[model samples]
Target: MPVAQDVIRHAAERPSKLAACGPGGELTYAELAGKISGAARHLLRRGIGPGTIVALALADPVELLAAVLAADLAGATPLIGDHTWDRRRWSQVTAPVGPVAFVGRPLPYAAGPPVRREPRPEDPAWACFSSGSTGRPRAIVRRRASWTASFPHLSDLAGIGPDDVVLVPGPLVSSLYAFAAVHALATGATAVVPGRWPARRSLAAHLAGATVVHLVPHRLPDVVGRSGSSLRAAVVGGAALAPGTREEAGRAGLHVLAYYGATELSFVAVDVDGDGLRPFPGVEIEVRPEAGSSFGEVWVRSPWLADGYLGDAAGPLRRDRDGWVTVGDVAQPYRPGEVLRVRGRGDGAIQTGGATVVPEDVEEVLRKVPGVGDVVVVGSPHPSLGAVVTAIVEGAPPRALLEATARTGLDAAQRPRRWYGVLSLPRTATGKPARALVAARLADGDPGIRRLT
Candidate 1:
């Protein structure tokens, strides 16, 4: 069987089943399969053969997924380039790799079908950018099998099935959206993609009938908090959900599914509503035996772990020969059943006034403030405290909003020392907040905002 035959196989068995939905329109399994085959044939005619590099630069999800599958079927190595990619950087990445085919968008010149070659389980099949939380972006690569292992867990947690229509609001350039899209198609479900995620547009898309929606908590409140929709489930990641936001979404008849995962490790654990976090049946979680190990750094070994970062053949993503891997996330083993609680990313934790603080815990509180759309919390270097908490909020709130949220019925240590407002928080290509960018903006003296600096 071919590498990309899963979707086609499902389509063959359920030709009339719903396969995808997006801004353009809806497509049935039979229709998507036809399009994939057509796309593959087109690539073949253009001389895109086995082992060739194909970059998808289009904005449309249907076309994007179709083109990706086509490249896989035609035996090409598919690398997705974001529409917002820097032309110079794109050239640099593609230059070392040699000539690559373009999909979803028009090419400059015409070519013939590239040849097809079979890829082993270890061959590089996918590449994506780093979240850029700590520094400049780096390329991360994964093998086909490792990428596919997250499918069952993702589908199960999202409650995806033949009858479900999954809405992907984030960009497919990121591993999150790409995996969700592939899972939806492979499971014979409908996947929807919007040109961009705005509050009204997202609500409209869901109202038009999106059974399962993927959103960052930043986007969730705007879509489900005020407007009504036919959404049954919402898988949230990229940021933490506010205390009241999840309850509000639940009131709107949407089951908010919180996803805790990294690009290297697909999904560590998932929690629905307030049910708590649980390990996916497909993965084994190990807690590090270091000091202050309260689900401290989590070590994971899953079938879905990526093969390795692109171009680095020395095997950097590997474990200590014992099959344990880490993406630098702090997790504590929760309760009886080996459940895990994701504290936050290792790099994002801040040391404030001699106590270490996880910004996610604070951001969750800030997000619940009225009029606050999204927020990012970072620890700015401070002489006395070592590091002080600073926050950048997407929406402007009343002067009392910060204090009110800070008084979370908790101690003063949990409150942010500084808060500022911005029109929009800078996000990575994948719609995740770019912490470094936020810090840079603040350093540049962005005016018109309150600050406790």
Candidate 2:
């Protein structure tokens, strides 16, 4: 069964349980099911199902959930659209995905039957835009069975049940928060989604007593700083999880679990209770290093992987003759199923002084240093070295602290030659350091980033 049908089961088993809460207020499973059924009927009556892709361009989390699950029930694949994107960003992602039934407006009501028939479990249930901070976004379509298989595995791993209240912070347009919201409903847990992403200082109120809160790692330090948070766990992903952030989370009595996942490969590896990154439940991963490369490409094989990019030839997702897929992420080849450390995207490597430096390798060392919250390392134009390794980092760190850490952990080529500081790095909609934007700022010498002595 698709995840949408799971909600119907919850409606029968625990009808009065809170299904979801957002700006539109809370809805019980029974109430939510009624709305989904009505909306799904409306979609099918209008001849939108299976073949038709429904673009859910909703900023309101509550409405998006209703519309998305309803679209699934109606057998139409829902494309989660990011409303926060400007016209240019939107066009960049959508131009390739031709002819979708864009649902920018509220869904119409059904005049007749509530449901015609169930959607195929094998057909696509959702399509989401890739949220890589440095690269062009592409639409990754997913089959209904992929999410269906994930619900049970993920819920069991997290111990989510009807008693848990899961909080999804980021906009639903981003796959991170979208999965969190839908996963909560699929597991019969109450999902609370704020109208907007909460400010760093205001996150505690949203987290208090919530069993689980899903967010990106960039915001983890600020969120963990707030006291009196009785959260069962804070599940973070979409960026490198800083060592300092995890340490701070421990001091605040917040359990933080980080996962390394892409829009194409749903949940590849997860760090449970700070044990370290291991293959996610039911996901098979291996590191395949190219010749003369220290870092190896991490390939994953799983049922949860996305179908494929919609209509883009230049996308990063690649597959071998075998069923394994890789997005060019380089990682340390630990023993088969043992702990893994993702170096960074291969295309993101900096060629400085005739040696390649992976930004994540440098960032990992810097992240362990005191006072560095988050960081992005890019190649700065250098006449002698082609491009020198330059770092634009968030958090106010003293010059001595960074220099000392770099000197000890990094070699000559890997160490950042130029150091710049910002109060905070610009983040994508998914809350990752916007590397492309920062690279532009570096090129233009934007005053937003002041040179660190």
Highest-scoring model, TM-score: 2
Against the reference, the lDDT scores of all candidates come to 0.66, 0.76
Give lDDT for model 1. 0.66
Task: Encode model 2's per-residue lDDT on 153-225: one tens digit a residue.
Answer: 7777667777899988767766888888988998889999985567655566777657788876656665665
lDDT of 1 by residue, 338-437 (tens): 5576555534555455344656667777888889899888866564464578888888787476777788633566577777788877564557775544
TM-score for model 2? 0.75
Q: What is the Å distance of residue 116 in model 2 from its true position?
A: 4.8
After superposing candidate 2 on the true structure, give the runs of residues whose Cα lies further than 4 Å from its correct spot: 84-92, 132-135, 200-202, 346-453
Backbone clashes for every candidate come to 17, 0
Runs of candidate 1 with Cα error greater than 4 angstroms are: 1-4, 13-18, 45-47, 93-99, 102-119, 132-135, 199-202, 225-228, 289-295, 313-318, 332-339, 347-452
Q: How does residue 44 of candidate 2 score in lDDT? A: 83
